[model samples]
Target: MIGFKLLHEKNHSSATHKGTGAWFGSKPINVDIGQNPVFLLRAPDGSVGAAISSNDSANAYKQALITLVKNTLDRFSRGGFSAASLEAAMLGGAENARWKWDRMLEIVRNDFTNIKKFDEGGLYYRIIHFDPKSGLAAVSRKKANPDDWNPASAKLSIESGTKGFSEGHAGGVVANATRFFREKTTFTALREVVIPAHLAETPDAPFLFWSAACSAGAEAYSYAMYIHRLLTRAKATCPFKVFATDINQKLVEGAKTGVYKANKNDIGEYRAYFRRYGELDGDTVRFGKEIRQFISFNTFDLKQRPRKKGFRMVVCANVFQYYDDAARSHFLENFMSAVTRPGYIFVGPMRDPIIHALGLKKLTKYKMFMVE
Candidate 1:
C-alpha cells in the first residue's frame, strides 16, 4: 500500500517498485520557463511499471527514461528488456510549455508505440496515478487518490455502476473484444473432455457451467447452444444451466438480450448451430427464449465469491495473460473454491504456467486444469 509522489520542477526524477505499491506524478511544479510532463511505462504482461517525473529538456527526458528502463528490467528479473518493450503514458505539463513537451514526447514516441497521452492544453492540472499490478493509470482533473487503493477492488477510480469509459482499467466494456465463440480451441476441448464426463457421472443430475469474464455473453450462449444440442441427443433427463457473469453491468444487460450480428464468415464453423439456437435473419441473429432460458446473466466480479458453487467447469478463457504472477495465483485460488472436486478450469489457449505450478492436474489436450 506504500506510494510515492513525484513532483518534478527543476530536475528529473524516477521511481520503480513492486506490485501494489504505486508511483504517482502529481500536478507539474512550475519553477522555470518550462514544466515537466509525468512519464509512465509498464511491461506488456503488466509485471513492472516505471514512472519518470520528466525534465523539460529532451536530453534529460531521454536519459531519465533509459535509466528507468534498465531499472524496470531489473525489477522484472528480465535481462533483455528495454523501454521499447513497454506500454507508455504521459500526462500533465504546464499549459504554456506545450511546445517544450513536443520534443520530450518525440523522445518517448521513439521508444514506445502503444502510448497514451494526457499532457494536452486543458489537462494541465490533471493528476495521474498508476498501479502496475492492476494495470490501472487513473487520470482526471478532479482530485484523485491512488494511495487508498486495493488492487483486488476497482473502487478507487470508478464506482461499480458509473457510465462512460473506465479510464485505465481495460479501456471500456463497450469496446470488448469478445464475440460468440472466441478461443475456438478451448471450446473444442470443453466438448471432447469435460462435457462427456459430467454427463456420464450423473446422468439425471443438474449440470452447471460458469463462464467468468464473459464479455457480452459470447461463450455463455455458445455453451448453452452446445449443451442444449448435447442434452437433446443424449435424451437424458437432466436440468442444466450456464451462469454468465461480468464486472460491467452494461455488458451483462446487453448479453441478456441475446442478439448478435455475425455474418457467415464471422460465424465460421458454428453457423449451423447459430441457426439452431436463434432466429437468424442474414447477419442479424436473435437467440430467443430457447437459448436464453439456459443462461442467467448478471454483473459479477471474479474477485468476489460466487453466491452459487459446484460448477462442473469454470471457463475463464481470457484475462489471465494480462496479469502478473501474484495476481494470477490470487484469481486461480478463488476459482478453485467455487468449483467441484472433479471439475475443470479452462484458462484459454494463452495458458498460464502457474496452473501446473499450483499442482492442479492438467487436461493437456484441452489445456484446462482438473481440480482433483
Candidate 2:
C-alpha cells in the first residue's frame, strides 16, 4: 500500500474511479474515491465479502461502487486492467488543482486503523478499521482461514458486536426521484397495479405499505407523497400506513424528523416534491405534517421476522445485492412472508434477477414483484 502524510485542508468535491488491478489479499479489483472513499473486499475463494464507506450517508456511492466491481469482474473475469493504471490514464494531462490524491490516500491509510465495527443489511463486517473522518474504512474476515475465507471454518460476525449505520445513507430526494421513484411512473404503477391488487383481496382493510431498509426516510416520504396523490386522484378514502424501517437507528431518527438537508440540485427542479409532501425550511427540508403523520419510523432489523405481517406492498431496494445467495434467499423469504397473499415487493433494478431466481413473479409494468 502507498504511504503519505495527511493535509489539514478539505476538498468539498467528490471524485470516483472504476477499473481493476488493485488487489487486497488476492482479490483483483479497481475502485478509488477522493473525499468519500469506499473499499469493498471479497475473499479470494469468494466465500466472503466486505464493504466499507466513509459515511453512513454515502449509501448510493458504496452500493454503486460494489455493484460496478462485481459486474466488471463478472463480465471480463479480470475486470478492466489495473485501477492504478486506470487512474493515470484518466488523469492524462489533467492537473490536481483542488483535490490532493496523495493526501487522500494517506488519510485513508491512517484512519482505517481506527474502525472497530461494521454493519450491512444487519450482518457484521467483523469490525476492522473505519475512520469516518478520513472516509477510510476497511473490514476483513473476523477469523481468516489459512486459505480461503471459508465459512465452514470462520463466522463473519465475531468482532466487537457493534452495529453500524453506514448503510443507511442512500441519497437525497431528487436523487431518489430521478432514479428509483419517478413520481409520474411510480404513481401510475401504484394506482394501476399495487392499490387495485390490494383492494381486490382486502376490500375492507386499510392498505399497508412497508419500506424495508429505508434510509433517512426519503423513499418512504416519497411514497407517502405519491400515495397521497394517488388516493386524492382516485377519490378513495381508504386509510393507509407507510411503515419505514431500517437497522440504522440514527437514520431512522433522521427519517422520523422528516427533515432532509438536500443539495441545491436536489431541491431545484423537484420543488413540487418538497412543496407538496415536505417544505424547505432554510437549509433543511421538512416533510409536511400530512405526509409525516402517515409514516412510522422504526429501527428494525431486516434479519428478524416482523412481529406483524400482511402488508399490501413492501419496498426493499438497493440492499439485496450485498448479501450472498443464501442470505438473499433468507431476506426474500422474510419479505415475501410479511406481505399479504398476492402482495407486491418493490426492489431496485439490480435486484430484479435475484427476485426472479427466487421464483417470484415481476410486475413488468413497474419493476416490482408479486410473491407467489
Candidate 3:
C-alpha cells in the first residue's frame, strides 16, 4: 500500500487515463476497479516482471483484453522474451463478469497453457503488489479498499480488435510460424538460441539458414528480420543468407514480392521488427531490399534432398505433422544431411514427437537440435 501505485479504468468519453506513471517504474502496482480482471505476467527467465489489470466498464472487458494482449506482446519482444518463455498469472475477476471473464481466460489459457503457475478467482476487494523486472508479486485482501470506479476516458481499439488472437496466432509468441495460421511464431530462438549457438561453435563465413516450408514467405521474412536484428545489435555484419523453399511454386512467387497481410496481433507481436525492416500500409506489410537481400525463396519438396549442403540452420516448422513416420524420417534425413555440424534444426510441437522418436537429440541449451 505504501509503494504500490493505483491504476484506473479507461473512460470511453475522455481521451485520458491514469496509471502510465505507475507502470513506468519497477515497483509493485495495483489496479482499482469493480468486477473486471487483472493479468500478471513473467518472462521465463524469472526476471521479466509481472502485471495485473482492473477496469470500470460494463462491456469493455473484451476491448481491454485485446489491448492488454497486444501491449504485453510488444513489451515481450522488446525485452527479448519468447512466447514459450513468457509466463502469466491472472487475477481479479468477480462473479459479476464471470461469463465474459471466462472467455478472456480461455484466450489466455490457449496462449499460456504451460504457465509457471496460474491463480484466479478473487471475488472481493483485494490488492496486488507486482514487480515487472523480476516478476515478484504479493496479493492480499483489503478490509476497506474502494472497488467502485466509473469510466473516465475513451476506449482504445487497434485495427482488428480481438480478431488478431485467432487460433493461428498461438499466443506462445515463442512458437515457430511457418505461414501456417494455427502455429504462431515470433523472434524466438534467434536471440537466445540460434545466434548464440552460431557464435559459440560455428562462426563461419557465409552463414546460411534454411526455411524449409516458407508458405507465403511470412516465416522466411520473419527469420530474415530476426537475423538482421541480432547481427545489427552485435555490430557484426557477418555474411549470412536464408534459403527459403516450399513445394508450392505460387507461394514462392508471391514471396518474391515480399508483402503480406498483418493482423492487429501480427503488428503487435512484430511491431519493433516491422518498423525497422518493413513498411506498414494499413493492414498490408511489405519488406524492402534490406531484409529481402538476406533471403531467397524457391520451390522445393521436403521429400527430396537439396543439392546444396553446409547450411548452418534449418527451420521446417510445417508439413511434418501431416506426414507419416516414414515420410518424416525421410525429410529429416535429407535436411539433416544438408546442415553443418554444430548447427540447428527448429521444428514445431506437432513434429516434436517424431523428432524424439527418431532419437534426434535436442541441445540442452537451445530449442534447436544439433545438425550433426
Candidate 4:
C-alpha cells in the first residue's frame, strides 16, 4: 500500500494540495466513488455489513474483507494452526484445490445478491482481485467484467495484503476538464484543440468518443459542443457518437435529461453548455435535442467489460486522482484498448505522470495525451 502511494504520487507535479477543514467524510455527493460505492460483507447471522469507501476505493472493502477473514480464521485456528493450514484443512485438501480462495470470493458474491446489475440498473463496484494464494481481496468502485469473475466460494480465513472524485480534489480536476478547452492561447489551444477538430473533419468518418465517469453529462456535452462547432465551421457531414457513462443510474438519467440546476458559480458555464445545445429559462437550464442527439448516456462501470467498438477519442478527466496506481493502470489500459491506434486520451492534469509512464506522448502542457 505504501509503495503504491509513491507510485500514484510519482508524476503528480503539483503539491498534494493540503486539504483543511475536516477532510475526512467531507466528500461531495454525485461524484464518482465519493459516497455511493458500498460493500456489504455477510455476517454469520445471514445479515449484511455495509460501508462506503468515501476517501479511496482501494482501502474500502478490500481491506475490510481481509481483516474480517483474518480475524475469523484466527479465532477458528486458536486451537493453534496457521491460516493456510486452517484453510487447507477446511477445503479437505491441499492449496492446489483452490477451495480456500473460492470460498472467500463466494462470500463477496453473496453480498451482491441485493445489488443491481448494469442491465437491471444495479449498483457498480469493482472486485479487482480475489486471490486465495496471496490471501488478498481487492474491491473498488468500478464496473466488473463478468468474464473475469469466478463463482466458486472459498473458506473464510485471514489473509494479508496491501490496498475520486468530488469537492476540493475533484473540484480542481473538474475545473481543469472545462478549463482545458477554454484556453485562448493559440500555441497551447492550437495543438490541443486542433486534434479533436481534425478528427471530426475527416470525410464520412464516424467520430466516436467515450467519456468515462461523466457526471450529469456536463463534460460530455462540452465535447459535443466542441465537435458541433468544428464540424459546423468546416461544413462537414460526418456522423458522430458520444458515449457518456457513469456508474450511477440517477446521474445517467439526469445526464440524458440534460437538465441542470445551476448554482451561482455555474451560471456562466451552464449558459455556455446551453449554447447551441441547451436553453436557459431563468435558473433552470435545459439542453436542446441538437447537441443531445450526438450523445448517448448509459450506466456503465469502467471496471466491468469494455465496449466492443473502438473510439477516436477518450476523455476520463477530473476523476483519476481517486484511485491508487493499479486502478489507474486499469483505467489507462481500458482506455487505450478501447481506442484505435491513432487515438487520443484526455485525463486530468494530475495524471500526467501515469500517462507518460504508459508511453503516451503529451499534447498540451496540461492533460491531453496521444498514443505515440
Candidate 5:
C-alpha cells in the first residue's frame, strides 16, 4: 500500500533547516507498489488530505494513474515533475474519499506484519509495514517495537549479493574512478597520491584507510591491493592497515576476510594488484608485510562521528548520495574534523558540491582532480 503524509509539526521545525521540501509547502504523495496500488496524499499539517484505494477501486483507474506516472517520469526524467501538478491531476479523479487514519491502519494491518515506526534520528520517520521482499514499512510510533529499533537490521535484508547493501553505488564509484582517474591519470601518479610520500616514510605507523560505506568489500580490497603493490614496488619494510566499514556488519566482516566471487572485469585489476602486494590464499586475499601492517577492517556508519582521528587519508567515495543535504553537510564536517592537515579526502563523483562547498581543494594531476 502506498502512503504519504505531510511533514509532522515537530518535523516542520527541523525540515526548514534540513532543506526538506515538505516543510517548504510541498506536500508528499506516496504511491505503494504491489499487485494492487494504494495512494495517500498527506497535507503539510501531517494529515491525510486524500486517499485512493486501488485495491477496491476500479482497475482501469489504477492502471491509468500508473501509466500516467510512468509516462510523466519517462518524459520529464525522475527530477522533472512538479509535485503540485501531479497531485492535483491525480487526486482530481478520486471519489467517495475518506479521512480516517484508524480505519486505514486497520485495513492495511490485515495482511501486513511487523508494522512499526522507524526513527533514524530524523524528521522523516514514518510508520511502515514489513514485507518479505521490500522488507519493512514505516508505521506510526505507537505500533512500533522498541526491541526492533536497530537501524542496521531494519536497513539490510537477510539475503546476500548486495541486495540491500550499498554495493551497487560502491561499484559505481569504482567505475567512475576507472573512468576519471585510471583512464585520465597514470598508475604511477595514482600510486603517488594514494600511497603518498609521507605515508611511505612511516610505513609501519599504523595507517588506516576507512571505506565508510564499503559494499561487498570490492573497493576496500581494491585499496588494500593497491597499497600492497605500492609498498612492494618500493620494497618497503613496513605494513599499512586498511579498514573497510559498512552499516551492515555482515558485509564488513566479509571484507575483513577478503573472500568474494570474482567477476573477470571487476576482480582483474584487484588480483593483479594483490599479486604485487602478497598472496591470495583460498577465498581470502592476504596482504604481505608491507601492506598488512597498516590495514584493518571494521563496521562504521557515516552518520556517526568517528571516535579517533589522525588518519592520513579517508576514502568516503560515493556514500553521500544516501543522505539528504543536511546529513551530507554534517558528515562532511565530521570528515574534515577527522582527517589531519595535509591528509587526503577522497569523495565520489556526485559529491563535488559538498566537497567544494567546504573549501577542500581537489588534488590536481595532469589537469585532473586526483584523490587517492
Candidate 6:
C-alpha cells in the first residue's frame, strides 16, 4: 500500500493571459491594507499559492498587471478566449500593444499590497491598496481625509475598549461639530451656529435633547455632562430631559448600564464637571442624579418613523453618511415630522444638502437649524 499525505495532492488549475503578456492562473486572490501592499494567491482548492507586494513602485505596477491577468481569466471563462491559446496570443500581442503592456506593468510594479479576505453580501471580497496619486485607480478606494474628523473612527476606538468620553473623543466630536457648522453656513447661506450661549446660562430649562443615533452611549454621555454642568451652574429650578436613541440593541444596553472608564484626561476641563455630576460604579460612569433624571435612553432606528412627538431640539449628527441619498431624504422627512414647530435640527457636515432640501430654515451659531 502506498501512503500519501493529503497536503501533497495537486489540484487541476487553468491559466489565461491578456493581450499584453500578463497571465493569471485559476486561484483566489486576497487583498488587505498594511504598511505595504500585499497580495496572496490561493490554489483552486483554496490552498496557499503565492504572495506579493513591496515598497518599490515596480511592485505596485506588477500588482496592477496581475489584476489585468485576472481580468483576462474572467474574459476567457466567458468564452471570449481559449485558455490554451491565451499565453501565446498575449506574448505576441504585447509587441504591438506596447502602451497596454507598459501601463499594465507600471500599475503592477507601483501600487499593490495588504491582501486580506473579506466576506460581504454572501460573497468574498478582497481589499487592495492603490496610490491615490495614480488618479482614478486610487480614487476607487475610499481614503480618509487626514484632517477630517471621522465619527466612525471615534466609534471604532470606543468599541476597541478605549474610553469613549475622553478628550480625544470630545475633540473628534468638536471637530465634527465645527465641520457641520461650516457646511451649514455655506449651504444655508447663513452664519454658523456657535455652542449655544444659553448652554452656559440655563442648562436646567427643561431641555428637550434628542440624540438620534446614540451609539454605545458616548454621545449621550457627553451631552449629559454638558447639561449637568449647565444646570449645576444655573442652580436651576427646572430639569432637562434627554431622549437618546440608537438602532443597536447592544449599545442601548451598554448605555443603560452607564458603565465607562473614568478618563479625566479625555474629558478635559469637563473632568471637574463630571466629578460633580457623575457617579462611578466599577468601570462604569453613571450620570449624576440631576443628569440621570433627565435622560431617557432608548433603542430606536432613525430611518423608521419617530415614536415620540414634541422634541425641541434633535441632534442627528453622523447618521446621514450611513444612508444613501433616497434614504437620507426619507429620514429627513421623518425627522421634520417628528419635531415640534420651531424646533432645531443638528446634523453632521456631509448632510447639509439633504438638510437644505428639507426646506428647514438654517439657524446661526450652533450648526443648528430650525424646521418650523
For every candidate, C-alpha RMSD to the true structure in Å: 13.6, 14.3, 15.9, 17.9, 15.1, 17.2
Taking the tens digit of each residue's C-alpha lDDT, what string does model 4 give over 157-230? 11100002222122232312333133223224323564455554466778777877776777677677777776
Q: Give the TM-score (vs. native) of candidate 5.
A: 0.45
Best by lDDT: 1
* Model 1 per-residue lDDT tens digits across residues 1-372: 112344432233222222212242223222211123566666666656656553312223356655654455465446345656666776655432243345457666765676677544421334445665555555433221222121212221223312222232432223245767766655776568776887778777788888887877878998888877777887868889999988778888989988888857767767787778777787878898888889999887666667788888888864553333454566678778888768888764322356667778877677678898
| Predicted candidate 2 versus true structure: per-residue lDDT over 1-372, tens digit per residue | 211122222311121222222223232222222112334433223332333333212134334434444553343335433322211101100011011212223333332343222222222112233222233333232222212221111221212111222422122112122222532445567879888776676657888889888867777887887787777776677888899997778778877887777777767756787877767776577877888888899988777878769788888875543333455556777888898878887654434355667788877778677875
Which ranges in model 3 have alpha carbons more than 4 Å from their true place?
Answer: 1-186, 350-359, 364-367
Better of 1 and 6 by TM-score: 1
**Candidate 5 residues 1-372, lDDT tens each?**
223233332332211111011111123323221112233332223322232333222213335444433343344334443334232101111011111112333343432332332123221223222221222222332211112322211122122213323443322223112111122232344476646654645656655555556655666656665665676677776646666666767666665664445545534545666566557654445556654445566777676788868666666654443334455566666667776555666553323465577777776552223223
Please estimate how well model 2 matches the true structure, expressed as its whole-model Cα lDDT: 0.50
TM-score of 6: 0.46
Residue 24 displacement (Å), model 1? 37
Alpha-carbon shift of residue 330 in model 1 (angstroms): 1.9
Candidates ranked, most accurate by lDDT first: 1, 3, 2, 4, 6, 5
For residue 325, what is the lDDT in candidate 2?
41
Each candidate structure's TM-score, on Cα atoms with residue i matched to residue i, is 0.54, 0.54, 0.50, 0.49, 0.45, 0.46
Better of 3 and 5 by lDDT: 3
Off by over 4 Å in 5: 1-190, 197-206, 235-239, 267-271, 274-294, 350-353, 364-372
* Backbone atom clashes (below 3 Å) for every candidate: 0, 3, 14, 12, 16, 40
Worst 10 residues of 6 by lDDT: 88-97
The model with the greater TM-score, 4 or 5, is 4
RMSD of 2: 14.3
lDDT of each: 0.59, 0.50, 0.58, 0.46, 0.42, 0.43
Using alpha carbons, what is the TM-score of model 4?
A: 0.49
